[model samples]
Target: MDARLAPFATTPRLVVKIGSSLLVEGGAIRQTWLASVVADIAACRADGQQVVVVSSGAIALGARRLKLGKGGRGSLDDAQAAAAVGQIALARAWAELFAGHGIEAAQILLTLGDLEDRRRYLNVAATLDRLLALGAVPILNENDSVATQEIRFGDNDRLAARSGQAAGAGAVILLSDIDGLYTANPCEPGATLIPTVARIDDVAHMADGRSASGLGTGGMAAKIAAARIAVQAGMPLAIVDGRRDHPLTAFAKTGHGTVFTAESCTSARKAWLAGRLTVAGRLTIDAGAAAALATGKSLLAAGVVSVDGDFARGDAVEIAHAGSVIARGLTAYDAPDARAIAGARSDAQAAILGYAPRAAMVHRDQLVMV
Candidate 1:
């Protein structure tokens, strides 16, 4: 056990990548095992953490439903067909499992292109943020029904890493059939688990490209690649055994997983918010609000003096004070609504907007002081 894995259970935002090999077996979903995983997720939610799940089982489950040969290569059409059928079952199963714990589950299907394009990436990020803000856990999987080799993420490992990056997850957990990385395939003799990876390349040769289960597409190589992507993006990742009951809880308590540490990307996130955004409009705030933003506080509607521009919710906008740019951030309300609520108290949000949304016009997490 290692203390380094504690963040996997304690981080404010987490993305858990569940492999199909661990989730499905013998032509059906592993109900008992999945229940245990759900329990772990429930525990995380109970601790006030937001979680996003990148699940891989649609193709495996679909193949079973269609009576396709298990663990064998199939035509792209066949794979797509299986995904179309299996996705429904997978989503339903996840919904049911989370519902047992009074948590709502949302299904989001995407392809590589969705994440590769800048505009679509932002849209996806916004959607995930909204879902988390609404107290719902998003269950994501690749949209296999229409994906081809050229545009598809060959494995869910990379997809999970990218999804976590887009959602700004603080940590990622890869629940694989194996416990963690080893000098060699653990199934083989003389392979010992490596508890921590400081520099992935130093041990990149250690990956034997072994996939523990026929149902899962990713192997050690994929996991390593995922680790590289996540770490560079400032999100720590962990690879742990998922076969046991309450695996997440166990890993946290026993520190049994291989933890890949990475620095937080606060400056990078702020830079993106400040420079990469296309200013959709402007929000003129009072001097008090400007000072508050300088201190890293979210921009409140109470401090907003005027709203200009035709920006929609989630669009990036400049924050102005006395004809000077103070900060920039994503708006939580549309231009019309923002105008109506300018200079209003936080408590009046619901009454003024006809529905309760966020308290801040620009959340601190999405704002950058310029």
Candidate 2:
């Protein structure tokens, strides 16, 4: 594993997520800080690196602009209203900052469903790629105005991680209030900074007592969760203090953060599958079936030992072994169809089901090898 921080300095593609606390001051937008961030991003682009910024502060900006006190957590409707109001100012602030730097910034708002649906996910990825190709920096934010309980990323931390994965970024820099992960809160006795985290699981113990910042929904816990998502999607992540002067620039030159290296360089499809919050169902396969899948073959109905869970066609599902998940894919058939075809002979498929759409339960294009 190449764990050096310098790799981030020259990384061709980067995702930088700035927290609300860093972007707002006295309950209002801080144009100065936004300008500094834009300058750093411009410097990165000057070095030939493509950059994407996943930013928070819309809610804060909205709340301040509307003069709404921070007492609306009790009502979901009120919170959404704040996000709705803040999103505009947030985008405008970003646009104006980038304009000063002579760069065009595109506001790309996304919902959890956009990332969950394979087709839409790929479309968003393609659009972001095209924007980058055109020398435009894509400013990403969660679609809080439209997202609900079941389809929300909850905070910009996860959104940033997903953006990094979707953009195939080499590194994801999570700028937060704190410098990095520590054995304990650095303000407390016996606390020490943990410079490197080779495995995400290693930091689980350190995240227990951490709490969210007053200005942001995500705390250190969310940052760790985001790191796990980024690592699983084959991207390295660094959590550093955004409060520092030129945080991204300094972190790139010196290792002043908790660096989480990716486990492996998985393909984009597999990364998408791995990052999903839930699978629709499971397709159990025999040993031959598992081997075929491992060899990059499509999953045929004949190899399925059983199907479990209620799922519709085009929904994500898991391919399992004795117990563990071996793969995940978009099912070509609904639950009833899949259940009826499991363990059935290929020749008998049409006879039993009265119809068949190809023989495979999932085509190779829809399947992601675990």
The candidate 1 region of ten consecutive residues with least summed lDDT is: 269-278
- What is the per-residue lDDT of model 2 for residues 208-301, given as tens digits with 9 covering 90 to 100? 4233557777888888888888888878788887886677777766778788887786777878887776788899999998999999999999
What are the runs in model 1 whose C-alpha is more than 4 Å off? Answer: 1-3, 264-370
Which candidate ranks first by TM-score, i.e. highest?
2
Error of 1 at 166 (Å): 1.0
Model 1: how far is 56 from its true place, Å?
Answer: 0.8
Tens digit per residue, CA lDDT, model 1, 200-291: 87888877555677677789888987887677677889998888988888888777868888754656456445433247799999989988
TM-scores for all candidates: the values are 0.71, 0.85
Residue 299 lDDT, candidate 1, scale 0-100: 93
List where candidate 2 sits over 4 angstroms from the true fold: 1-3, 185-188, 208-211, 283-308, 319-326, 342-352, 355-365
* Alpha carbon deviation, residue 338, candidate 1 (Å): 43
TM-score of 2: 0.85
